[model samples]
Target chain A: MANVFHQRLDELDELLVDMARRVGEAIEHASAALLAIDTEAAAAIVAADEDLNALQFRVDDRIVELMTRYEPVATDLRFILAAVRISVDLERMGDLAKHVAKSVLLRAPAPAIPDSLREDFAGMGQAAVRISEKLVRVLAERDQMEATQLGLDDDVLDALQQRVHDQIPDLGYGPQVAVDAALLARFFERFGDHAVRISHQVVYLVTGDVHLDRS
Target chain B: MANVFHQRLDELDELLVDMARRVGEAIEHASAALLAIDTEAAAAIVAADEDLNALQFRVDDRIVELMTRYEPVATDLRFILAAVRISVDLERMGDLAKHVAKSVLLRAPAPAIPDSLREDFAGMGQAAVRISEKLVRVLAERDQMEATQLGLDDDVLDALQQRVHDQIPDLGYGPQVAVDAALLARFFERFGDHAVRISHQVVYLVTGDVHLDRS
Candidate 1:
C-alpha cells in the first residue's frame, strides 16, 4: 500500500509540473504579445487561462483525496502542501498573463511604445521567463542551489522594474501610453516574484526550511 | 489525547480569529487615512503593518508545529489547512493596506483628491472593509451564511470600482490624478477579492465543498 501511494504521489507531482510548464509558456507568449501588440497571441493566452484554472482545481482535489486516503506524514505531507502552494502561485501567474493580454488588446492599434520603454519591457519579460524556467528545473531536480539563485534573479527583476518606472516620466508619451508601459512593467515584475515564490517552495520541500535566503 | 489536541486546535482558531480582526481594523484605518489624506494616519498604518506580518508568521509557525506533532486527520486536518490559507489571505490584505497607505504618502501635502473622487474612494474602501470584517466574523462563528454573502459584497465593490473608472475620463483631472485614482480603485477591488477568497475558504472548512454559491 505504501508503495502504491508513493507511485500515485509521484504521478501527481508530474502532472503539476506539466501544468506549471504550460503556465510559464502562457506568460511568455503574453509578454511577447504585449511587446509586439499581437492581438492573436494575446487572445491565445487569454483562452489558455481556463485550462490553467481547471488544472489548479484538479490538483487541489487530488491533494485532498490523497490526504484523506493515504494520511501522508512528514516529508510526503510537506510535498503535497508545497504542491498546493505552487498550484495557487501558478494559477495567479496565469491570471497575470491574462491581465497583460488584456492590456495589449485594449491598447492595440494605437502608437507603439517608445523604443526605450519597449526595451525595458522586453528585458523584464525575458528575466521573468528565465526565472520561471529555472524554477521548474529546481522543482524537477530538487536543486536547492538553483532555488537559492532565484532570489538574486528576483532582485534583478526588481531593479529593472525601478528603471522602467524612472523612464516612465521622461518617455515622452501621453498619459495612457505611460500608464500602459507602467502596467506592463508591473506585470513582468510580479511574474518574477511569483516564480521566486515557487522556487522558495521548492527549497522548503527539499530542506524543510521555509525562510531560505533567495537573494 | 484526542480531546486535548482538539481543545488546542480550538485555541488556535481563536488566535487566528483575533489576528484576522486586527488585520481588518488595520485595513479600515489605512483606507480612512487614504481618503482623508492624513499622512500621520497613513504612516501609522505603514508602521502597524509590521504587527500584522509578525502575527501572520507566528500563526503559520504554530500551524506547522501543530501539524508535525498531532498528525491530525479528517476534520481536524481540514481545519488546520484552512487556517493556513486564511492566514495567507489575511497577510496579503495587510500588504494591500500598506500599499494604499504608501500611495497616500506619495501624493500628500499637494493637491488633495477632489470631493467626487474622494466619495468614490470612500465607497470602495467601505465595501472592502465591510467584506473583510464579515469574513473574519464568519470564520470565528463558522457562519456559512455570512461567508456566502461576502461574495456578493465583493461584486458590489467591483461594480463601484467600475463606476470610478468610467468617471475617470470625465473628471478632466490632470494625468497624475487620473492614474493614481485608477490604481487606488484597482487596489480596493483586489482587497474585495481577497475578502471573498477568505469567505470561500471558510465555507470549504465547514462543508468540504470548494464551490459554494455566494449568490
Candidate 2:
C-alpha cells in the first residue's frame, strides 16, 4: 500500500509537469500572436484553454482520490497539498494566456498593439514566455535555486508592466489603442504574478515552511 | 471524538463567515472610495487587506490542523476541503477590493471614474456589496439556494463591465482616463468572476459533483 502511494505521487508529479509544458506552450503562442497579429493562432490558443481546464479538473480529482486512499501524512501530505496549489497556479496561468490571445482577437484587423508600443509588449511577452518555460523546470526538478531565481524574472516583468502604465498618457495613441495597451500591460503583469506564486508554492513544497514575507 | 471534530468544524465555519464579513466590508469601502475619490478610505482599505490575508492564513492553518487531527473521511473531509477553497476565494475577493481602492489611490485627487462612468460604477459597486453580503449568508446558513442566486448578480456585473468596455471610445476622456476606465472595468469583471466561482464551489460542496460547464 505504501509503495502504491509513492508510485501515485510520482505519477501525479509527472502529470503536473506535463500540465506546465502545455501551459507554457499556450503562453508562447500568446506571445507569438501578440507580435505577429495572427488571429488564427490567437483563436487556437483560446480554444485550447479548455484542455488545460480539463487537465486541472483531472489533477484535482486525483488529489482527492489520493487523500481518500492513502490519507497522506507528514511530508507526503504537504507534497500532495503543494500539488493542489501548484496545479491551481498553473491553471490560472493558462487562463492568463487565453486572455492574451483574446486580446489579439479583440482588435482583429486593426492590430491590438500600436507600432510605438510594440517593443514594450514584445519585452513583456518575452518575459512571460520565459517565466512559463522556467515554471516547468521548477516543478520537474524541484530545484530550490531555480525557484528562487523565478522572483528575479518576475521583477523584470513588473518593470515592463510599470513602463506600459507610465507610458499610457504618453503613448500618443488613439482611444482604442490606448485601452488595448493598458489591458495588455495588466494581463502580462498578472501573468507574472501567477509565476511568482508558483515559485512561492514550490519553495513551500521544498522547504516545508510557511513563508514569512509572503504572509 | 466525533463531538470534538464537529465542534472544531463549527468553529472553522464561524471563522470562515467572519472572514466573509470582513471581505464584504472591504468591498463596500472600496466601492465608496472609488466614487468619492477619498484617499483616506482607499488607503484604509489597502491597509486592512493585510488583516484579511492574515485571517486567511489562520483559516488555512486551522484546516490543515483539523484534517491532520481528525483524519476526516467522506462528508467531514469534504467540509474541510471546502473551507480551504472558500478561504482562498475570499482572500482573492479581498485583493480585488484592494485593487479597486488602489485605482482610486492611483489618481490621487482626480476621480477615478468620470461623471458619465460614475453611474455605471455605482451600480457595479452596489451589486458587488450585495454579493459579498449574500456570500456571508450562504456560508453561514449553508443556503445553497441563495448561493445559486449569486450567479444572477454576477451576470449583472458582467453586463456593466461590457458597457464600460463599449463606452471607452465614446466617453471622450483623455488617454489616462481611458486607460483607467478600461482597467477598472476589468477589475470589476474579475470581481464578479470570483463571486461566481464561490457559488460554484458552494454548489460542489453541497452536491459533491464536478461542474460540467466550467471545465
Top candidate, metric lDDT: 2
Per-model TM-score on C-alpha atoms: 0.90, 0.96
Predicted candidate 2 versus true structure: per-residue lDDT over B106-128, tens digit per residue: 88799998999999999999889
Clashes of each: 1, 0
Model 1 lDDT tens row, A117-182: 777777777777777787777777878887768777778889988887777656665555655666
Which portions of model 1 show Cα errors greater than 4 Å? A111-116, A212-215, B111-116, B212-215
TM-score, chain A only, candidate 2, equals: 0.95
DockQ, every prediction: 0.32, 0.55
Among the candidates, what TM-score does chain A have in each?
Answer: 0.93, 0.95
Per-residue lDDT of A42-138 in model 2, one digit per residue for the tens? 9999999998888888887787888888878867877776777677678888888898899888888778888887898889888887887788889
What's the lDDT for residue A110 in model 2? 74
lDDT of each: 0.76, 0.82
Q: In candidate 1, list every pair of residues with a backbone clash.
A: A151-A214
Q: Which residue pairs in candidate 2 collide? A: none
